[model samples]
Each structure stands twice: as C-alpha cells, then as structure tokens.
Target chain A: MSIRDLARHLDISIGTVSRALNGKSDVNPETRERVLAAAKKLGYVPNQSGRSLRQGTTNTIGFMIESTIETADNGGSFFMPVFEGVQSVFRRHHLDLVALLCGTDEDPSAYLNRVVGRRFVDGLIISATTRNDPRITFLLDRKIPFVALGRSATGGAYPWIDLDFEGVAATAVTRLVNFGHNRIAIGVPASDINLGYVFQDGYKHALAANGIPFDPALVLPAHSNEEGGYQVASAMLAQKHMPTAVILVNENMAIGLYRRFYEAGIHPGRDIAVIGFRESTQSRFLSPTLTCFRISLRDLGIKLAEALLSTMPAFRNNYPQERVELIWPMELVPGESDVLKRTA
Target chain B: MSIRDLARHLDISIGTVSRALNGKSDVNPETRERVLAAAKKLGYVPNQSGRSLRQGTTNTIGFMIESTIETADNGGSFFMPVFEGVQSVFRRHHLDLVALLCGTDEDPSAYLNRVVGRRFVDGLIISATTRNDPRITFLLDRKIPFVALGRSATGGAYPWIDLDFEGVAATAVTRLVNFGHNRIAIGVPASDINLGYVFQDGYKHALAANGIPFDPALVLPAHSNEEGGYQVASAMLAQKHMPTAVILVNENMAIGLYRRFYEAGIHPGRDIAVIGFRESTQSRFLSPTLTCFRISLRDLGIKLAEALLSTMPAFRNNYPQERVELIWPMELVPGESDVLKRTA
Candidate 1:
C-alpha cells in the first residue's frame, strides 16, 4: 500500500528503504534490490500515496530552448537527447526538468531575466549562447545557479559545459586533408554564436597546420539548418576553384546538402566528400551516410546538470569539487560520405 | 528606451504601440509596421524593458512530455510544432509555456499530481495518452484546467484535441488497398495506449469493409521509434504471406524502416509499398519521399490552447463556446514511397 508497508514486509527500516528507492549510494546493492522487489510485490508506489508538497526546494530546473523556424523544420529535434541527459542527472535528486521557450522575436536577456527574477526554478541550463552573451552576466548578477551549454565570452568564473567544437573541426579537417583534399570548403553558421567562432578557429588552424592556405572565400556562412546547407550549395559549386571536399559546421545541414547533391546529380562520397560536425538521426539516414562527429548529448546534459549542481550550495555536497569549465570531446563516426580519396 | 518612448516618437497612442508590438489584432497593418520600424530604430525591447512580476496569474503553462528510450532515436521531435502553436496563442495572453518532462520510470499520474499540487502551472497540455489514463481523472478532480493532446476513454467530458488516428489508419489502409494490395501489415505501439486501439479499430474496419479478415499475426506491435521499426522489418520479412504493403503508426519509426529496407535490399516504394502516419522534415528527406498524412502541428497546438482556455474560469471569455472533444483531421500527402501500383 505504502512505502512503510513495503518496509515492514521486508523487515527493513524505512530510512534504508527510502535511500535504496531514491538511488542513494549509502544503501547496499543487495538490500536495494530486496527493497525494490518488496515494494513491487506490495504495489507500493513510493511517490504519491498521500504525498506532501516537496519541502524547501521547487525540485525543478529550467532548460531554455530557442523557438524559431528552423526548429520546426527538422521535426523540432536538436535538443531532445541533451534534455534526456539533463533529466537523468536531475531525477537522481528528484529534481524535475522543464523546458522554457525563448521566442525568435523576444530578447533573450529580458526573457531570461523574468524567469530568474520570479525564482520559478532552483537552477537553469541555457544553450545557443552568443559569443558575447549578456545572459551569463545577467544570471551572475542575480546570483542564480546556472550552466551554459556552450562557452561564452563573458569574463567571469562560472560553471559551463560546451562541446569541443574546435576539436571536431580540427579532426574533420585533418581527416579530409589526409585523404588528399587540398581545397576543403567549410560551412559555418551565419549566427554570431560562440560555437561558430570556435569551430572556424579549429578549421583554420587545421588548414594552416597542413601547410594549406586558408582562403576566406572557402568559408561559407550559412543558417544552421537544412535550408542553410541548401543555400550554400550553389555558391560552393560555382566557386572559381570548386572544393573537392566540404566540411559542414552543423550536422542538420547535411539534410539540405544531400538534397542539393541529389538535385545537381552529384554523388556525395565521390564527386565531393562531406563531413558533418555532428552525427544525428537524419545524418545517419543520409544516402551515403554522413561522416560526422559524435557527442553523447545525454552525457553532455548530465555534465551540464552536474556543473550547475556544483554551483548551487544545496547540491554542492553531492557534486563536491567544482567543475567551472568543461570542453566535452566528440569522436569521429566514419561513413561513406567522407571516404573519397582524391588523386589530384 | 521603452515602448512608451517609441510610441511618443511615432506620435501614436501607447495602446496602439503596445497592441502593434504584441501582435494584437486591434492595430492597423500599416500603423503596426510603422510602430515596428520605430521600435527597431529606437532600439526598444518592449516585453521586458521594465516588466515586473505579472499579477493575477503565474503566467506559465506546462506542456508535459514523456521522456523514454524510444524518444531519443527519433530526436524527441513530435511535440515541437505543437509547442510553437501553443506559444503563439499563449503569447497573446502574456502566458509563457514550459515543457515538463515525465521520467521514463516515473508514473505520469504521480508526476502530474506533484506538479499540480505544487501549483507550478496555470494549465497543462499532456500528450501520449493511454487508454484509461488516470492523470486525466486526477487533474479533473483537482479542478485544474488542462487539455489532453490525445484522446482517452476516461468516461468524462474533457477538453481534448487529439489527432484523428482512426481517420489516418482508415485512409492509409484504403490507399494501400486501392494500390491492389490484399496482404497488408500494420505496425502499432506495443504499449497499452489509446491510439493503438483506435488505430487498430480503423485498420480492422477498413479491412472488413474490403471483405478481408483481420489476422492477429498481421498486426505487428512494437516500440514507437526507429529501433522498433528496425525490429519489425525481419518479422515482416518472415511472415508467411509476406505482405505487399505495410502501414506504420508513427512517422518517427519510418527512419528505421527505411534503413532496414535498405540493408535488406528491399526498396521501400518499389519492392513493397510503405505508408507512414505523419509528414515531417525527416519524412520529406526520405530517399523516395514518404507518403503520409499532414496536419499543421502549430494549428493543432493553437486549438489545444484555446480549448484549455475555454475550460478555465480566468480565460473562459477568450474562448467562450467550450469545445469538450475534438478529433483534429490529417490530410494525405502523396509521396513516391507509396506509389507502387500493383500490376499483379
């Protein structure tokens, strides 16, 4: 009937049963299993059998997402896995995760300020950070425990977890160069986000390391979605010295790139090699399959939550040593799209 | 500096400026453009320039999403457009929408009850309903204003705006039947959800109308995702009848279905006709394109919000004529994947 009933049936103390059910480390694994089996057998749902309002904490964190045209384009994906990762970490503490939408027309700082000012959440996790994000400073001014999913230029000691976009670009470029690709064109986001700059820096450094002159014209600034990828295709093809291989800054762009390649009667793996920045379901479904970088979004999300928890005093004991900055790495998942060997 | 300053500069009334900026219908089109241009020129951020805690309302709506393993494979995309739709209407009411995640292991009813008891949201819009969802009854008993994104057999009049699964199934079955296919397999969720039953009912009715008997073996129930779609492939091939066509219950599953078909050397539109349940960016990007149903998720979301507002005492006037039940329609979108005309 209740947790107490299950505890009595198991002949275990209520505290032990509660710890085991809540995934506390203090409980013995065997005891935890016994407690769980007893609870299941008794049909005891630990959560809401005359539950009281959670004490002190709201037990909720907010993840602010960008609401724009592109989000709807790819079936509104882009953030689901990362969300799952955050939730996994939060659920351990029974902290619920809620998504806050920032409309395309709204000012990010103002929108965020209202949410934080209301103290609707215990902490926050925000993504799509601008190169010089004011929201970071805004959060700090309010002394709100938070984590930015991407790095920001705001000068301060704050918790953050960002994908190693520089490393991804370097690895992608170096791999293509090793395949004898001399004229490698890259498509970066036209947005003034920090990730774009970091990604491009790695790309330029990789090119220079290989003794290849980085042409400004070779870098294409486009939207971060499929349409952005498609818009860059014609210009890429019409270049004076057409690129033999292309490195895309975002994986979602691969969808449009594939469409362009298909329409132009060009084979992705042969006519021109393509390497996407991220590996996504759509990229995996691409005809030639996309050679892209793989970052465990869920893992990144867990790290993000942990990073935020480290900042909060209430959760400091669980998180322990502070992790103020983290540059998460991504690995290569090779596919036919980037397997072209250039003879020239 | 502010909306008032912009209005003063434009020599327009403050009400006109506010209406124009918030996208209210009272403002003249040309005047709205002028107000916008002036606001941009003056660098005015209207919503939160000096906005404070909103009175009379928490000004937040919760959109509960199910966080499960199947969601990750599909990019967790099903609800985004709908979110956008909800936000579009909510923004008009100065209400913000937030996504509430229901953990894979957690009970939905418990989660909903916790959130409601905490008074965290003004209203709720919950999706992925089961046949006899206790959450609906729980919310109703609490006198909470909420909307179900899917239908349920809970034996009460509640504001629900669910997709017409029955119509979708019937239409898909009829189309496949007209393509000269007698043996058709259909995939539905293995979970005891309401849509599964409604969809199957339509499938059975469609078959019966065509004078074909329903075979239990022909009804393949699996997870509602890509992996599930992949799992269904081998079984589909193993069937003694070897269905000439198959209907998928979820669009997200189509991604895996395509991959399995490719690996098995069976072309989707050629070897065996395939019809997916929904049209999305992924479906559009499919090699042969996907023949499926189409509905404006944003519009559906708007309707959902309006329906909820109709039930709420505070927002009842905005949506006077209460709509207790709505079966939203999904029109067919013809694509190459289901164009195989049976010559036999």
Candidate 2:
C-alpha cells in the first residue's frame, strides 16, 4: 500500500496524509497518529525510490572503498569494525549504509563518478583516502556531503578522521631513543598516501626532538603486509650500519618482519627492537606480542559516520561541529616486541 | 546529462537513443554510431535510479556481508579477492556491485528484507551462507534472481558455487592417516554453516574410507581465528587421548596455534603434526609454514558471478547453465605444519 491508497481509504487529501506521515507541524497530532496507525496496520513499507524522488534524499549514505593488492586485507582489517560503529550511528538516524567498491580493473574516479553522478546516496564515507584523492575533488565539485576515513593532503573544509600517525611515530621513536638506539629504521607504505607522509614527518620530528640526527637512509617504504616487513628487515640488515630498532607503520607487516628476524636468528626483544603502528588480533598473538598503538576501529567508524552526518543537513542537530573534524589518536599497548635496549 | 536530454538534443525519440546506447538490433548501425558519438561528446552518464524505475531493474547487485565478533576478520580474508572476481564479471555486463553489511543491531533476515523491499538492487550475491539460510527461501518466494557464494541446505534449485570442503578434508585426513596417525583431530566452525557440516562429513567419510573408526571426541569446534586456533590447541593437549595430528579449517588461526605450541614447548611438525585448511599470505609466512590447500579466490569469484548471471534473464545469453553449479577444489601446498609420524 502507498500513501495515496492510505489517503483515499481515510477519505483525506494526499497532501494531508503526506504531512501527517512526515510528522510536520501543519498536521493535527491526533490525525497524524491515526494516519500512522492505519499505515502500520496496512503493512505499507515506504518505497525508497518514490519518496527519494520527491524528497531529494535517499536516507542512505555511501562508503567508497578501493581495494589494491597491498591494503586489500579486505580494505585493511580496520574497516569492518569501523563500519560497525558507523552503522550503529546511522541506524539511530534511520539511515542506511552501503559500501561502493572500485573493481581492480575499473578507474577509481570513473567508478566513483558513476554512483555520485546518479545520486545513488545522500552522503558518503570515503575510506583510505590518498594524498591527492580525486574523489575529494569530485565530491566537492558536486557539493555532496562526505567524510574521509583517512587524512589527505587535498586542502578543503571537508570532514576527515585520521589516525594520529605523527603521535605514533614520535612515541615509537622517542621510546626507542630512550633505550639509547641511535640507528633506527622505519617501514612505511611506498605510496605517497598522507599517512606515510605524516608518519615520516613524525619520525623526523621525534628524532630532532630527542637530539638524534635525521637520516634518510633509515626510511623503508614497503607494502603493508608481511612480505614488506620481511623486505624491510632484509634491507635494514644489508645497511653498513644496521638499525638497532625499527618502527613499522602497519602492524600487519610485523609478521613478515618477525619471520625474517627469526630466519636471521635475531630475537626482537633482545637483539633488534621492533615497533608497529596498530595492534591487531593477529599482531597481538605474535611472538613477543607486537608493541603498538590500539585504536578502537569501531569508535573511529562511529566518528567517521558522525562526521559525514555533521556535514549533511539532515542530521546536524544530533552531532556537534567540532567533533566532526578530528585527528583520532591511538593509545599505546605495551608488548614485548619493542622492549629491548641497545647495549654497546 | 541523461538519455532524454541527449535524445532532445539530437531531435530523436528516447527509445531510439536507448536502443542505440544498448546496441539493440532494431537501430540502424550508422544511427547507433551517431547516437554513441553524440552521447560521448555530450558526456551523458545514464542515471541508474531513473532507468531502474522504468525498467523494473536497478542494474545493481548487492553482496551481503555479515560481521560477527568471532568470524569478523571482516568475514575473514577470503571475501575481497572473491568480490574482485565477482565485480570483474559484473562489470562486463555493465552491472554495479554494492556491499550490504548487516549491522550487529539488525536481524539478518529483516535487514535483507529491507534492502530487497526497497528495490535497491536487481539481484544479490549473498556470502557466508548458513546451513539453513532463510535468504534462499526468501529470494525464491520473491522470485528475485540471486546466487550464494557458498552452499546451503535450504534446498532449492538456485545457482551456487561452493568450495570442495569434502575434498580438502579427505585429502588432509588421508594424508595424515598415511603418516601413521589413527587419532586425528579436526577444527571446524562452531556455527551451523554448510561448510562446517560438509567439512565434518568429509572428515567422517575420509576416516571411514581409511578404515578408522569415527570418534566424536576427535571433532573440535572453535572460532575461526588465531585465538580459536590457540583454544583448539590447548584443548587438544589436555585430552586423555591427545590427537597425534590436528587439521585447522581456517588458516588465519595458524598464528595462534603456533604461539600456543611454542608456549607449551611443543613442536608442531615433530611433537604433534598440525595441518591448516587454506594457504593464505598470513599462513604461508608462519615459522615453519602451514601445510594447506590452495584455491584461486579470483577464479572462484568469477565463477560465482557467472553463475548468478546465468540465473538472471538479462544476462542468460552471456553465461551457460553448466558453469553455474560448481564444487571448486583446492590444490595441496606442502608446508612443515603437518609433517610428522607418531611414534606409537
């Protein structure tokens, strides 16, 4: 059954029924309650297409996820939990969440344009934002409401919630420096994503803050997997002056780094101190559990979704303005992975 | 810019424009060429929402993903690669793929009904099908074209592409049996999903085929993760008739199993042979490597999508019926995880 049918059955005009159903102040409260009771009793599920056409809103949000071979641990293990948090908040607002994925074969911008161009969603939650994201420009040009799950160098008034990469880097480096480690290596994504840039800047800032000389030779760009970790370890070992400790941007790569260390007969907690960015379930169980930062992915997702809604006209009243734009920080979880002191 | 605007600009009927765009036989080749050229020159992007309303199809497919705390490695590492395969095929047919995640607060069947009722997609690709999936009956009753990524016992003549769980189990069991082990323990999902049932059936069949008595005590149900693997390992060690060998269903859990073994000062390959089901990048890099089966996830996804298309009336001509139903097998990759003879 539709609103027109309900209106006809109640011997009322369609406009009156629409206003009553939408809870507008123009309608009588008793009449509105009566219309709602009749609609519910008739089992009339509102048709999204019909309503969205008239309202210019779908009551839905799009979360665009791009999958590359490197970060494709299903968009990095952080997505689902974050999605869970975002979904919870969306549900409170009677909004639906849909994820738009770019096929490996398709152009990312074109793929995004196809959905946004068609007004497939009212707003968007764009995850894993790169340094110069084209989607940001595309969305801005269209004036679509959106929030980025990660930081981007693309300057604009768009809402974004990124991990505190600088904090993580400084903490890892300072902690290492306290242990008297001058030669410290770092593993970051080879791509020029904003996180890598921030992570490097943090590393440099921490070294300078701690009176350690900056060395470009210590930076290792690798994929966010075990192979990248292994590659970084091998590369570090080959250096004329090997690093006594290493900081990994992504903890998933720690598995490979640990394996390579094991293969080289070097113990992490004793011989070479190892630190990782985020501690995951996998990272938690590693031999001498990876000492890393713990960011509540679900909370981040919740904040990300809230950030998007804050930009949208629909749900601005429920969320605060300042809370929408945030640099989400992660707390350090101490483990045995980076507890070593470099003794001469 | 839409088809109607393009037609108005060209002073032609909308049907002629549409037919030309879709490469229909009714349109003249030169007229079709002219329409395509003009459409491209004008940069007309078809409005999916508008077209869906008129055609009674959205030209979009929903891939439903459920995330629970236990199996939530974002539905494990298997989904994204398979989605890539599915998206690749869907792209060929000019279909958009969207991910539908069930929030922890929502009921699966109710959540599915909401999406389907709203006419959000033309068809669906439901992942992680349970033993008696309600979606099967729901889709069949609604007459919506859909496919399951894995098999279900819902019992209907619909398309499905499931892994060869029986083959993997039998191979693993027979291999372990050949290595002189009568007491073999197996870890399956605690959930009542079809894969778990089939995996257990295959284990039983393999045991019976090998002339070994089936002992109910040998079956261990655990969460499909590292902690689950650790739990299974701990339970195995405490048994009065401790298993000589153990087979893990999920390979991601290998990390936990290895850690537990190391903590217990028990050697996996020598003390108690351990075999994992799938060989993933994570499983491949374990200390001694995990002996598991390898299946091309991309190929599986391609088959799953193709199978769904065969059931879809719009794309029936592009795909054959025989390719719809499959019991895809995995190739055994030798690793040191399970390579020991029990000294009886």
Candidate 3:
C-alpha cells in the first residue's frame, strides 16, 4: 500500500497526509492519527535520513579514536577500559555506538564532518587531546554534544573525566620520602600531553612540601612504555648521581624499570625504591610487587556516557559551559618494590 | 511523508506505487517514473524491518564477548584490534557491527536469542571459547554464521583463528635449550581453557624433540595473570629440583614471574633463564629485556571479518560443520632474560 491510497481513501490533500506522517505540528491530531493508523496498516515506513532530518536524532553516539598502531597499543591499557564502561551504560539505554578510527595523518575533523553533517550520531566521545586541538574547536563551533576523556591544556569549555595526577604524584613522592628516600627521580612521558604537565607539577609540589629541593636533572621524560623506562633507568644507572628512589608516571614503564634494575645487579626492594601509576594484574605478582596507584577506566567510560547524554540538546542551541569534571581518587597498593627503611 | 501520499499525488494505484518502490519487475516504465517522481518529492521511505524480512538479511555482524573486568582488559588488547580490522573490511562491504557483552551469570543462549531472534545481526564472532560451549551449539543449530577466536575442545565444527601455542611453546623450549639451559619449567594457566592445553603440548613437544625427557613435575599450571605467575614461581623456587629456566605462556603471568624470581634472590638472565609468549611494548624494555613470541590481534580481527562475510549461507544453514582455521606465526625476540650461554 502507498501513501497515495491512504490519502485518496481519507479524502485529504497528499501534502496534508505527508505532513501528518512526518509528525509535523501543523497537521490536525485526528487526521494525524488516521494517517498513522493507515500507514501502519499498510506497512509504509520512512527512511532514516528523512526521519533524522525531520526528528533531528539518530539515537547513535560516534567515537572518534586515533587509529595509530602505537597509540592504540598504549590505549589498550589507557583508554579501552573507559570505552568498555561507556559501552556498558549505552547498552543499558539501548543506544548504538558508531566507532570511527581516524588515521594520524588524516584530519579527524573530516571524519567528524562525515558523521555529524550526515546526521549519523547525536553525540561524540573524544580522547587524546592536545593543546589547542582542532577537533575540540570544531565540535564546539558546530554545537555538537561531546565530552572529552581528558582535560585540554589550552583550557577549553568542555565536560571531562580525568585522574588527579598531581595529587597522586605528590602522594607517591611523600610515601617514598617517608620511607627515607632523599634522592628521588620523577619519570614521565617525553611528549607534552596534559597529564605530563600535571604529573610534573605534582612532583614539584610534593618536593617543596617535603623541604626537598627539586633537581631538574633528576626529572626524566621518556616515551610512555617499557622501552622508555628501560632507557631512563639505563641513563640513570650510567650517571654519577643516582636517585635512591624513582616515581614513574607510566605503569608499563615502571615494569621496564623493574627489569632494568634487575639486569644491573640491583634488587628493587632491597637496593632502590620505585613507585608508579596504573595497577595491572601483573603488578601484584612481581617478585617484590610494585607499589602503584589504580584507577578504574570503566568508571571513566560511564561518566563520559552520562555527560554526553545529559549534554545533548533536543534541538541545536548554545549549551551551557557546565564543565563537569569527575576526578577519581587514586589508591596506592604497597608492595615489595618500595621496601626502603624509614630514614626520616 | 508516507508512501500513500506519494501514490495519491501520482494518481497511481497503491499496489503499483509499492511495486515500483520495491523494484518489482511488473511495473510499467511511465507509471514507475510517476511513482518515483512522487516519492522523491514527498520523501517516502520503506520500513527497515519489512525490507530485512523480505530480503532475509540485516547486513550486521554480532560480536559476543565475556563481560568481566579481566576479560574486558584483555578484550582491549585481543578483541578491539580484531574488531577494528574487521570494521575496515566491513566498511568497504557496507556492513554494520553489533557488539554484545555477555555476563558470566546470565545464560548466553538468552542473549543470543534477543540478538538473533530480533534479527539484529547476520553473523557472529564469539571470543574466549571453552569446552562444550553452549553458544557454539546455538549458532550452529540456528545456522548462524560465526567464527571462534579460540579453538573449542568439544570437536564442534566451526571456522576459527588462534595463536599457535604449541608451536610457540616448543620454539621457546628449543631456544632455551640452544642457550644451554637443560632444566626448563613450563607455566600454564590454571583455568580450564583450551589455549592452556595447547601451550602444554607445545612445551612438552619441544623438550621431547630436543632429546630431553618430559618431566610432569616441571609442568606448572597457574592462573593466567601476574599473581598466578608469582605463586607458581614462588613454588618453583621452593622446589628442591629447580629448573635453570622457565617458559611462560601468558604475558601478564610472565611479568609476575619476573618479580617472583627477583624476590627469590635470582637474577633473570644469570641465575635463571626465562621465556614468554605474547610480547607487548612493555616487555621489550625489561631489565634483561624479555625473550618471547608476539601475536598480532589486529590481523586476527581482519581475518574474522572476512570469514563472517564469506560464510553467511553456511551460518544460516541447519548444520554448520564447515570450518576454517587460520594460524598466526610468532617471531622470537632475543633478550637477556634467556641464558644463551647454557646451550653453548
């Protein structure tokens, strides 16, 4: 059955029948019901694009992720858990998730345009933010509903979920200091991402609070992986002024440092002290388990989903800058890696 | 607008309008044009459910995954990569992905029913297979197209992609033997998964191939995580007849073994040699650097997607005995963790 038959049978204009079926308020309620019932009976359905253009919703969320193999590998531990958490909430709400892997060389904006301009999803979840990120500005200018996974360094007006890096770093330092480690080194990612800066600030703050002068030479920044840790430790071991303890920002790198120290004929717990972030299942079983902070990526995902859902407008309008920052508390798991006797 | 409105505007019979929109052979050319013109002007669209029912296809793939924090963590590493790889292929083919996370407490069959009976997906990719898995039977009996990520022990016929655990294990053993380490212990997962068995077979085969008798006492099966590794290694250390070297199957467990060995006052490369499978970026920069095999999860994902697209008919058939198996080759990276001098 076609709309023409329903219109002829109802003795109304075809345009009137069309307007009623499309849920336009201009159509009379009684005529709209009759048209809907007739269309339902005839099994006539509208197309997604047409429905989206009319109703302004796709009931889908687009996630634009950097598809680089290297970043993806780190994200396995860093970003994926958060995604799983977000998915859990979406599943409960019966919402669909559309994932787009943006290549490092390709402008992510192009992909976002394809999804947003084409009316594919109602909201977005973005990760791996940089200072003055073009993607953030594009999403903001377009009035697209989105929540960032991390805070932007340039200070954007966006809702985000982040860890208290500075707080955690300071805690780690103080714990090591209380254990009588005067010469402490801070290891962080070499690149300038927001977390690196936060960690550095925390390290400095903790040193000042403890009356220990910050040594610029003791602050080592390397790539955020085991190789980075191994290289940093190798360089430190070669230096004349070696630290009694080390605070690494990355978890995988700390694992590398543990191995590096072992290779250099040094016992992690007995000789030198170490602390890092991210508590992997492997951290607990290391001969002298690693003392580190644990954060739930899944919780981060749930928060991002809630933020996205709450921020979406019924129609395009300027959204309020309600920067909802969900900061998860870091818990330290003490292990054999930091067994230095208290000197203070 | 409804289809009936388009038909009425064109002054054509509802049946003729329906036939033309659905691409039926009997519609006259002039009448088809009239119907097409009216549909274009009015924006009439057919319903998706009716079309799918008529065509016997939804053009979507279902991926059922176990929903545990540990499993989810592994999913980021093992599943997401493959999912992305498959997505790359599916995007070209104009297919969609429907992901389902199944809980351990909930019946897998019920979840399968909601997705399959509701006609949400055309095929499935089931991960973390076990012996006599009910999911395998449900998909097979329903004639649903699916490929298992891991091999099933029940001898159920199905296409699958798996890591060559036996081959890699044997390779690890021989490598250790070549380095003059005769007494080697093999670490397996304490879980009842089929991969653990495959690893055991490989470890024994390699030892036998090198003219060394297999020692059941040397076979250590623990949980497939870091703590499991620590407990198993601690046990091995306490043993009167300790192996000069150890080969671990899982990467998480290997990290634990590294720590346990150190705590036992043993140097990884000098006092005891170690080898592990599944090399991550973190493993490369370990103190002694870890010697192990690496499997690409991304490659596995791409293959699964190709399989899903090809086996649609067999999947829809009552009997799903046809099977495809793809084995990924593992490469060995030399590191100080293995005592190379022992074999010489």
Each candidate structure's TM-score, on Cα atoms with residue i matched to residue i, is 0.82, 0.89, 0.68
iRMSD value for model 3:
7.6
The candidate that wins on TM-score is 2
* C-alpha-based local distance difference test score of model 2: 0.83
Off by over 4 Å in 1: A1-57, A73-76, A282-285, A341-344, B1-56, B341-344
Q: What is the DockQ score of candidate 3, to 2 decimals? A: 0.15
Alpha-carbon interface RMSD for all candidates, in angstroms:
7.7, 2.3, 7.6
lDDT tens string, model 3, B204-229?
78888899998888888876667767
lDDT by residue for model 3 (A1-344), tens = 34676788888998999999879999989989998988766445444434444566655676667655546556555555666677777776656554555544455555555445434467888877665567787778767789887677655577777788888888988998998887898888786567888889889999999999989989898877777788778878977978989988877777678778888887778888988778876677555678888777778777788777767664223334365777667888887788864435
Model 2, B1-344: lDDT tens digits are 66788999999999999999988999999989989999888657777666666787777889988867754573636777877888888888888888888887678877887887577788998877888888888888767888888898888888888889999999999999998889999988888778999999999999999999999988989888888889988888899988989998888677788888889988788788888887787666677788999998888888888888888888988878664667888999988878863455
The candidate maximizing DockQ is: 2
- Candidate 2, residues A1-344, lDDT tens digits: the string is 66778898898899999888877999988899889999877645666776666787877788888766754663536677877888989998888888887886677778887887566689988876778888888878768888887888787778888889999999999998898888999999997677889899999999999989999999999998888989999999899988999999988788888888888988888799999888788777788788999988888888888888877777888788764568888899988888874455
lDDT values of the candidates? Answer: 0.79, 0.83, 0.72
Angstrom error at residue B174, model 1: 1.4
lDDT ranking from best candidate downward: 2, 1, 3
> What lDDT score is found at residue B46 in candidate 2?
73
